[model samples]
Structure formats: C-alpha cells, structure tokens
Target chain A: MLQEHAKLITFFSECKELVGRKRLQKMIYILKKCQFPFSERYQFHFYGPYSEELTLRVQELINLGFLQEEKEKKSGYYQYRYTLTGEGEKFLDHYNLDMPNMDEHIEKMSETSSRFLELVSTMLFFEGMPKEEVEEKVLTVKKKQNYTSEELQQAWNFIGDMGIQH
Target chain B: MSYQSEQLREEKVFKDPVHRYVHVRDRVIWDLIGTPEFQRLRRIKQLGTSFYTFHGAEHSRFNHSLGVYEIVRRILENFKEHPDWNEDERLLCLTAGLLHDLGHGPYSHSFEKVFNLDHEDYTREIILGDTSVNRILKRVDPKFPQNVADVIGKTYSNKLVVSIISSQIDADRMDYLQRDAYFTGVSYGHFDMERILRVMRPMDEQVVIKATGMHAVEDYIMSRYQMYWQVYFHPVTRSSEVILTKILHRAKHLYEQNYKFKLAPLHFESFFKEAPTLEDYLKLDESIVMYYFQIWKDEDDEILSDLCNRFVNRHLFKYIEFNPNHQFEQWMELHKLFTEAGINPDYYLEVDSSSDLPYDFYRPGEDEERLPIHLVMKNDELRELSRESDIVEAISGKKRTDHKLYFPSDFIEALSDDSHIKKRILEILEG
Candidate 1:
C-alpha cells in the first residue's frame, strides 16, 4: 500500500470503527498537533481546520472499497457516518500495522459531543492568546456565544488529563 | 520494555542561555540527546562562519535544537486542552523538534555548496537508518523513527504536525529568532514571541493567531526581515563565508591536480570526491574542519596555503555592492587584471546575491509554500494575516535581492610586481 494509504488505514484501525467526517477531521487534527506524521494542508473552515487533502483521501478510500460512508436521518437532517469494509478489515490484518494507544483515544473521541469537541478545538485555536482574549473569542467563535470561562478551564483540564497536551 | 516505555522516570532540564531552561520529559528524548550522533552537533557551530563577523555567534546547533524543542514544549503545553489535541503522538512532536537539524555537517554552508550535501537528507538517515537516534526511536515503535523523520522531511501525513517544526510561524522560527539574536548580540530578531505564542490557536489542521495578536505577528514578520538583512545576510559574514568557500575550493582543486599536501584532508576526502556517506559526513564538524584549515596554512600549494591562512586568521575578503548584469565587463576585466597580478581569479573573485520574501501570504498560486498566518477575528471568521495587516501586505511576495562583488583586498595591497594592474583593479572595484 502507498504510505499515505497505510496512514489512513492505520488511522481507521485505531479509530476502531467508522466515524463522522467532522470527528475524523478533528481526530486527524489532534493527531497532527500532537505530532502524527501526516502531510495535508488545513485551513480554518466551517467546522475548524478543514483540509481538501483529507476530503480526497476519504473519497479515495471509499472508491477503492476500503471504507464505506453511510447517511442516516437524525432530527430531520442527514448525518454522514463512516466505517471500514470487509476488504478493509482483511487488508488491515494483512499489514498488521500498529499505532500505540489509538484504540483508547478513538473510544474517548467517539464519546465526545460535537459541540464540546468544537469548544475544545476552537479554544485551542487561540494558542498563545492571553487568557481573556481566548475566553472572549472562544465564546463568540461558536454558533452560540454561551460558553463560560469555567467550561474553558475545564476543557484545558480535560486535555491535560487525556495526556495529549503537548 | 515496550515502545511507550521510553518515557523517563523523571524529567531532565538543560540550563540554556537563550531559553533559560530546556526540559526533556521523555526517555526517548533524553536518549536521543545522549547519543554520540546528537552530541556531534555541539561541535558544529550554529552560525558557521558568521562568528568571524559577530564574535558572539559561537553557539552550536545543539543549543538551537534545544531551544526549538523548548518552544515546541511550551506550544504543546498550551495545546493540551484543545479538543482536537491527540495525546498519543505527543512524543513525536517533541522528538522531531529536538532532532530537526541532526544531519548538519561542519561549516554547513560551505560543506553543502562544495559537496552538494543537504543536512535534511542526513537528518532522515540518522533518524531512520542504523544509528543511535533511530534505535531509540524504534524502541518506541518500529515506525516511530520514520514518522519522526517524515515530520522533519516535511512529508509527514499530518499538516499541523509538520507546521509545528517547518511552518512560517512554528516552534523553529520562534526559538531561532530569540536564540540567534541573543547569541549574535543583535537587536534584530526580537518579537513578542510570548505574545505570539499566547495568541496561537489550533484551528483544526492548521495553527493560527487571534486577531488581537496581529501587532505581535507583524513585529515578528518585520523582525525576520530585519534579521535577514542585518545579521543573516551581513556582508562581513558573507565575506568570511566567501573566504571559507575559496579555501575549500582551492584544497579540492589542489587535491585533484595531484599536489601532495603537507596535511591531507582525510576527513574531507569523501567531500572532495563530492559524495559523502552519512558516517563520513557525521564525522565532520567546525572544530575538525578548522583544525585541517589550520594545518593547511603551511601546505605545499601556495594558493591553498594562502587561502587557508587568510581564513584561519580571519583575513576575510573585501566586497563592494556590484550588479553582475550591469558590471559584467568590468567584473571580467578585473578578473583578468587579478590573473595578471598573479592571483588566481577563480579562487579570489565571487559575487554573492542574497534575497528574502519577507512574508508570503497566499499569493493565489503559492498557497502551499506555507499556510499563511491567520487571525481569528471576533466575528467568528478567519482572515489571512497579510490581508488584514498593511505592514505585512506591503512586503508580502516582494523579494529584496542584494548583490556584492568580493575579492582579496590583502592580495591587492600586497602586490609584489610593481604593476599598475593593482591600481586599475582597485579603481574599478572602488568605482
């Protein structure tokens, strides 16, 4: 497999199941910031650090039948979900690739609400800003500017406890 | 122990002059530093020949590397609570930051130019091949070494991870600016890095600054421009660099011509052959290279001996601003005059052109160069920094190039054969 594909497959295997596009992007972004060796360009997009490279990588995996993207109606909106195919399972077993602590991470990531994920991701986006500026902007950057300084502090604590804070 | 067992029982700190203190928490990082290969960096001067111009620039790459790692460490600590921060790959970021410059040989500018070697290639080899660094990394995981190499190589699959080390406003730049300024004792390269860091935000797959921190970012951009022109591209340092290059060239030429030297540059044999293995390259550093230059001062070849003496004793060439295109014929005439005065024009004359695009913020077609610095505006939108800042916008995409003509001033002054050519050459050069 191409090294890029190996990375994608490995990411998927570590995730343990298919995930939503937003969650996957956040996961990949977290991995990259934490220093996983991936080469994709990202920009501040609708959800947060969006990448055209990742969009294409996901498409390529689906086209090759290594992954399946399914849509489900939830609250009158269609939500996209991703999962590995049977062939993807075989290919993964064949390579027997390993990524340390990815399984536990995927489990924790899966349990996170998208809104809370957005909060943490957006708060992080203000890396070197002063506590006040991060607090003020973190609240407004979201669709609803209702987040509190307490929540922001909690988000930081959560990141450290997870052992991922650089 | 398994791969994760590389974590240290306790953190170790290096008291740094630039960053104050550099902390290493992981055993992998500590082991990598302790490796002989990494220690070799201590013997290689960070600024190379710049020390000849700025006496204070005697720091080594090892010092700069630690500074880079410390900057990354702070940035990482700031990142810990970001919802998108991945806890597992924490060590990878630290490792890449620490070992980024591992492959650099002695007097890298001359070594790379004369021998066609890139320190990056050696960085990869050291991180992935049968080296102590690779062993320490592999003990973390077999793929860990390659993964770390890929980050330094700028081919890693994760864009944000790559940016931490290689981006326009990443850890590498943040550290080098302050560290270099501190060592060079120059006022340039000073920016509110703490402010810059404070305003940094992890935007999904890229890092950005808050709009409130725009001024600090602008100061950084301006500082970079000033440092490039003031310190990095200083003519005196370039003159020392030119002399250093000429010394290497003369040695290679004499060796190729079968002139038996009083001291053969055995360490530089592979380099003289223009093909250096990783081991051969690793064995070289500024001290070893300077030792050879010192001994070559009394060599059999007159040109080599003279050039070596000039470089070893800091007798650098003198230079004047000259456009090669405009002064082509005058330059050629001067070269001819030098040859008549019994100086080898090839070894004595050179033109050095240095340029920098102070900042390049997404010029439509050049989006991939670096993800331009972004500022998270209060309106819940992101704007490219140059788009919002007039100072950055003015200099963005504009490359300022400066050219200078260099020659042996002492040779012209020490002219033996009472020739008018020396006077004519000086007139043309001074004119």
Candidate 2:
C-alpha cells in the first residue's frame, strides 16, 4: 500500500508538470492499461477533443520542464511524440519501490507524515458522509480537545501557510 | 471587563476584491461601515455610468470605501512600525480614508452640475452632524470625529494624516486605480502595488516614495494614464453620461413647464426646486435613478423616453473624434443638418473632451496644487521623479486630451428615405 501510494503521487506530480488535468488523467488511465513508452498512433485516439484551456495547461507544463515533446516525420504527416525524462523516471522509482528502514524513529515519522495515509484513513471512516457531518466531526474534535481561540487561530494560520485544505 | 470595554468587539473583516479584505479591529470603523448613511454607498456606482462602457465595471462606492479602508490599514501598519509616523494619528488617518467618499451621491458629477449640490459639504455634514458615524467616532474621543472630518475636508493642520488619504498618490487614488482595474479586467492599470507600499515613507509634511522605487512610481503613473484613457475617459461612458445629463435636464425642464407625469418624480422633486436635504440625497442612489429612468421610458416627452431607453438598454450614442478648434465650421454644419433631420442637436449632438497631465515634475504658480512626486535619494537628498528617470521625464508635464462628437447612430439610420440631411450628417460623422 505504501509502494502504491508513492507510485500514484510520483505519477501525478510528474504528469502534472507535462499535461493538464484532463489529459493527464487520460494518460494515467492509458498507462495503467498499456504501460509507459506510449505509442504515438495509440495516443492519437485520445487527442480528438482538445480545448484552448487544455492546450494552455499543456504549454504551462512544458514550460515547467516535466515532459519533453518530439516530432517524427511519418509518411505525409508529422507524428507528435512525448516522453517522461530521466528525472521523472528517477522520481517514480524513488517513490514507488520500498527500502529497508535504517532508523525506526524516521520510519515511524514518515508513516505519520504521509498525506496519502492520512487521507485513506479519514476516507475509510467517513466514506459518503455529507459536508455538514464532516464539519460536525471537526467541531466535535475541537470541543473534545478543549482548544482555546488563540490555539485555533494558530492552527488555522499553520494550515494556511502549509497550503492544506480544510 | 467594564461594560464600556465589553462594548468593544473583536476585529471584523469584509472580503473585498480590491483590498482582498477590509479589516476593522476598531469598533468605530466597523460601525461606520454598517450605518444606513454609509450603506447607501452600495447603491451608488463608483465610476458613475462608466459601467455603460465597460460591462464588467458594475462595482459600487461600497467596494471603493472598503478598498480605501484597507489601504489606510496597510499605511497605518507601516506607519506604526516607522518612528517618523505618529502613533497618535493612526485612528484619524484610517477613519478619514474610510469615510472620504461618504458625501458622494448617485451620478455625483451630473447631479452636482444640475442641482449645484456639493458632495464634499455633505460629507462634512455626515461626519460632524448627528449621525451614527459621528456617534461612533465621538466614542473614540470627543474631538476625534471633528479631526477626521477636518482631515477629509483638507482643513486639518496635520498634513501627514491628510496626505495619506487625500494627496495625489494617496490611499484613495491607489485603491480606486487597482479596484477599477480589477473590476474592468484591464491589464494596463496594474502597477507593482507591493513595491510601492514597501517604498512609501512617512515624512514630516507628506508621504513620499523612496528614491530607489522610482520605476514603481513611474509604472503607477503610467497605469493611471492608461486607466484614464481606457476606463475613465472612454467615449462610450461619456456618451452615457451625456444621455444621463440630458435625461435629468429634460425631467427638470418638464417639471418647470408643469407637465404632469404618470408617476411623480419623488426623489428628483427637491433637486428640481434647487434645494435638497441630507436625507433626500441619501435616498438618491443608482437604483433610484434607474427606477426613474425605467418609468421615464414610457413618458410622453420624446427626447426623455428615447434617452431613457438608450441608457437602460445600452444603445449608447456612437462617437467620432473631432477638435472644436479645427472642426468648428463642420460642427455647425452638422448641427444644422441634425435639426433639418428632426433630431434635436442640443440633446443628441455633443463634443466631449477628456484630458489629463499624467505626471507633473513641478508647476510653481499653478492654480491646481499638485505636489510634484519626489523620490528620496540614497544620500537623503529629495529629487523630483522626472529629474532622475528618463521614462518619467519623457511623459512628465505632458497633458494629453481626446475629443469626440457623440450622436445617435440609430436615429440617423432610421431617417426617411428622402432625407438628404442624414447623408450630410453621415459625411460629417465619417469625416
């Protein structure tokens, strides 16, 4: 599960720099089906519905240096191509494959620090609850903790600084 | 805690597009914004008919008021940190900035012109008179409200506090420029506001920009210049103002002529008689004007009905560039042709000229007191902006003016087939 989470994060982070959300989602779907070093002709089937916003997002990704685009002359048409760089591949490898834990303290810290673990745990308990229910749960937690207003304000500030969603 | 101390509440915030958020830690500032008098700003358009040109610019004075407050808050924060800034005058500066536009009525410029009502006088009245804003201000200190009024009125001796809210590049102008740009969705009106704030220094008499940030100051001036042309002086906006002025004129004229209307002009009745109280003025906002315009669309007066429909539906008068000096003869000929075509030249045809000197280095004996923007040098010597910067020098003291003649294109198009006057008017318009 740890290896799977890392792989998903690496895949998203790497692809997000190259393509937009919709295209990246489609690319991830295709990769799950056919694996990497994707065929140019095979990807052409997915490029039917392109939008200006998508193009802009793709261009932004290209500017960010995540994906490299190549073009090959084929018959009477130019076949556009794309590939993940060495850096991207290394990121995926580093994140996906598990390693032997040298320090128990660091390993335990990583487990708690993992956003994916936290998200999964929270999702398991409150799978299809309404927003109000989630809010109520948060309020109940606050009440149970008996947090002061200043403490709450500090927590809110920390959350804002960390760019964490409520 | 004492009862009076308990009366004081925690900070309140209004999510504002211009200033991001208007923070009101003081009980007085928060209450002033909530007053019925101040709440009336929400009903008055900030740009006054500029929305007729820039469709997205439908923001009210309420937006600007909050923006002004935010800018003042930021200024006060900077001042509190600096030794040169007076800690005592913090509340005065903030209050003045927040309530600066308190006196403005709906379409203030036109209303003032027609009715001879001075918004500045009304602003003073609202602040010092028996009002909620005054009561809250007096709670701070007895003389506090008067000081705030004096600062806004430009009668205060403390130039430092007054300049923050009223000067050439003060909080008011800074907020409006950015707020207007954001609402209008224009890129030209953006200057590095963050940089400007960082470089602003509180001086003995006035606030001055640090000499190092001259580029930022130049950028601000350029933004103002662009906003003036692109937003403020937009010919379409002027055309709407023209139509609005004509509508008011027609209404006032009809009232004088004893012409009975379907619905009596309740809001405008006092204005027609050339006397309006503070209560009457407060009740008049963009909505009231709009309501009147809607009702006037069905009026028996042809000009009033036509103008009202044009204003409401945004069928604004089309304009062509014309210099009165160069095209005086042509203008007369066009006016004659308009009359021959059964179109009233007085109401339909108008020459509107908009001009502004973007930045002036110095004008020693000028009637309009414009303090030349001074940049504080590294060596602590003050140098005027144009002296050091080439870009600013090139544009400094240069006043640019644009003139355009507005007329109803639909009227000309709908003329009878036998009308040669329409052809003549078209020739003048095209030329």
Candidate 3:
C-alpha cells in the first residue's frame, strides 16, 4: 500500500469523524505547517489552502471501502461527513504510524469551526512572515471575510495552542 | 489617475490567429505589451517540445498571453452589470491575465524540474520586483501590483476575481486549450466558449454555469480530457522531454564536476548552482537553450554530446509500455546489462509517468482544491457538474497515468547480432 494512503487512513483514525471539505483541507494544511509528514502540495485557492492530492486520496479510500462519506443537505448547500470504515481500521492496524500528539491535535482542530480554520490556515501559509505582516496580508487578501482583529488574535492563539510557534 | 485609466485614441488590436483580434483600449495594457519583460515571451515557446512532435506548434507564450487577456476581456464584458460581480477589478483581472505566463523560462518544464524553479513564483516576482511590468503596474496604484499578483497567484481575497483567472474553467486554460490546438492543428480543444461565457453567473465566491450551459461545460471538460491525452501528453513529446531532462542533468553534473566546456555555460551558471536569481531566470529563453544545444553537440563528453545530438537533430528515443512496479527485477537486470554493454543506463534508460484527473466534483467525504464546476439550476439552486452530466461523471476523479520505459532503440539495434548482452536486453525488454 502507498504510504500516502496509510498516512491519510491513520489521520481518519485519529479524528474518527471529520466534516466539511473546506475544514478537512484546512486541518491537514495546518498540520503540515506544524511539521506533520503530510506530503500533499497545497496551493492558495479561494478557500485558503487546498490540496488536490488529499482529495484524490480520500476518494480512493472511499472507493476501496476504507472510508465512508455521508452527505447531508444543510440549508442552501451540501455538507459532507467522513469516518473511517471497518476496513479502514483494519488496514490502519497493519501499519505502525508513529504520529505523536495527532489525536489530541486533530480533536482540537475538529472542534473549531471551518470559517476560523480558514483564517488560521491562511496565516500559517505565510508562516515565515512577521505576525503583523501575516495579519495585514490576511486582512488585505481576505477582505471579503471581514475578519475582525479579535478573530485574528484568536486564530493566532489557536495556532499557538497547537504547539506551532508561528 | 488619468494615466491609470488612460485609453488610446484608437483601440489597438493585434491581429491574432487564435482570438481573431486581441483588443487593447486601455493605455496600460498597450504599454504593458511593449514592456521588455512582456516582449521576452516571444522567445519562449508555448508548448515547449510539443513543436517537435507537431511541426506547427511553434507558438510563443506572448501569443497565448494575449489570447488569455482577450478571453478575460470578453468574460468581463459579459459580467459588467451582474450584481455579484465587482466592476472595480476589471483592469486588475486583465493585467493578471496578460502577465500570468511572464515567468515561464525557455523549455520551462524541463528547466523547472532540473533547477527546482516555479514560473508562478517568478510571475509574482516579476510583477512585484524591479522591472518594467512592476513600474507599469505601480502607475495604477502602489497596491495595484500586489492585487494583480495575488489574483495570478490565486491568493487574492476577491474569490470571484481569482476564480476568473485560476479556476477549473478559466481564461488561462480556455485560451491554452484552443490556442495550443490551433497551433498544433488539432481539433480536440474546440468547445462552445461563447455559450459557457454567456451562462457564467458570478456568485459570492465563484462563477457558476447555468443549467442550460451544462452541455457546453461538459464539452469543455471532455475537450480538456482529450487534449491532455492527445497533444499535451503525446509519447513522442514525452520522449523528447526525457532526452531534454537528461541533457540538463548531465550538463549540470559535468559543470559541478568541473568538466571544462569549449564554450563556458554562462547562461546556465546560476541554474547549475541551483540559485538562479530572477534576472538570471528571465535571461534564459528557448533560443538561448537551443543555441547551447547546437554548440554542445560537438563537446568532449560523449554522453552530453550524444543527448544534445539526439535532441537537436530529432533523433529521439523510442519507448515501450513499462510497469515499474511489476518489472523492478527485470529493470534492474536491464540496467546492469546496459552498463555491461557499455551504455550508461542513467541517461540511456528511464521510466517516465504522466497522470491527470480529467475532472472532479465534490464526492461526499472527499476533499478537492479545484472549485468543481457548479450548474445553477432553473430554480436558483446549485448542482455539481459531474452530478449533472453523465460524460463528466464517468471520467471525474479518474486519474489516468501512463508509464513508459524509454531507451535508444537505434543503440540496441546497432549491437552485434550475437552480442549476448544485446540479446539479453532485447529478451528482457520484449519478454
């Protein structure tokens, strides 16, 4: 089996159930920025950081019955919920993936709203820049989001809470 | 302020083969087209080595860039009064479209693979760096260059603007598919662009197709699929790319090992060191690369000479369908056999793979970065494209990959009839 598949299944196992495509993309990008071994290449899209490779991997997992995707209509749009299947768990048990602090980190990330995760991931995307510059960029590029300073501060604090220095 | 929105007395137009006439009413666009950086695009081929396979594919990035700008101009014209669209981003969108491919070096793909460079990154740099493009953009506003850069980089806050240029179906892909098809003389890239443009509705964050225009969108998707398989990923083109990549690798290795060249590779010095400045990168064009290849064909290094000769004279390597996963042991044996047969397997033998997902939609739990084409139904609701179109759905998320083992068939055939190594190589390759 490909290690990319193994890593993703392990991620599903850690989170148990992850919802919303945007949230899933943001979570993995944040994890990758925090020095996790997710190897998907991310490009800046309308929805902050997105990885096509991750999406393809998730689809493959679904096709193999290793993961389950449940779609629910929410108001005006569709929402997705993902959970590892029995086959996913069995497949995961075969590989000893040593991802320390992943469960707690993913759980903490999952609990947060997708909208806030977008700001967090966007900030992390410019991780090397000064905090002030990143904030300025977030404000400038994401003008439509109209993120308040309070939300920006909270996102920075959340990133810090994840043990990411930036 | 006047200079920012200055228009020429008469609308300037380039008589284009692809877009018919690339119109320029804005003085800024005219000035931008005259910039040294923009003019440099004439030296860079749009399809790279596809010209070797399709003799007519000699179009330049300059040609494609103008086509992209024209498409955006038409799209924006259609979008003028839409409530969801912002009229203020007109110039920014056009500028971004025109300058999107400004950073592409000569033989961009092979050079990028060899030197770890990205044309998109350079595109941003050229827009923001000390160049004529930056100067022209700054005339609009101090922040104008950054806005255009962000749009091209797909990082602009205005999702609608970014989507127009960088989305799944956008001006760049639209122009390239048609322009490359026109230049290469293939029919695979034609689609109902006018219908798709007419149906495009600006939502809060993206451009959605009306359900009525779903067939046009499907046609566009199938066109992209066919173009990828037919022209873009042609085996002959890949074979040329393989040789081009090896030549760069061998030259870089030779340079690093202090192998003296009859003519010093000054143009490639920074690239070989893997630290090319923006200026160094921009200085290289397809002509400069070919000039070097022409001279390097007679160099002292046999491998370098042979590869350059193969590329320059179109003596390309032939390939056989190869599965690396299933033939690892056989490949290893062939590698040893080639080496024993006095052929360097490193340059002479390679397995290249190319894969593409034709189109994809939001599969329940799967995540995608590409904004899946959405159809706005008659009732003002949105439906994903693949879900709405059977043709798109059939190919959606199906990533097709082709792997080929390329080698010099002429070299193998030149071996003695009874040469044990040659027979064994043929047996392994054929068997």
Give the worst 10-residue stretch by lDDT in candidate 2 chain B. Answer: B356-365
Error of 2 at A9 (Å): 75
What is the C-alpha local distance difference test score of candidate 2?
0.66
lDDT of 2 by residue, B17-41 (tens): 7667777777667777889989999
CA deviation > 4 Å runs, candidate 3: A1-41, A51-121, A139-166, B356-368
TM-score versus the correct structure, for each prediction: 0.71, 0.69, 0.84
- Among the numbered candidates, top DockQ falls to 3
lDDT of 3 by residue, B1-431 (tens): 48777899999989998778989999999999999999999999999999999999999999999999999999999999999988888999999999999999998878877787768789989999999999999999999998898888787778889888888889999999999889899988899888988999899888889899988988888888788889988999999999999999999999999999999999999999999998998888889999999999999999999999999999999999875445656887998999998999999998775521212332322343446778899899988888878888887754555568899999999999999998999998887
Comparison by DockQ, 1 against 3, better one: 3
Best by the TM-score measure:
3
TM-score (0 to 1) of chain B, per candidate?
Answer: 0.95, 0.94, 0.97
Candidate 1 chain B: worst-modelled 10 consecutive residues by lDDT: B356-365
Off by over 4 Å in 2: A1-166, B1-9, B355-368
Candidate 2, residue B137: Cα displacement in angstroms equals 2.1
Error (Å) of candidate 2 at residue B421 is 2.0
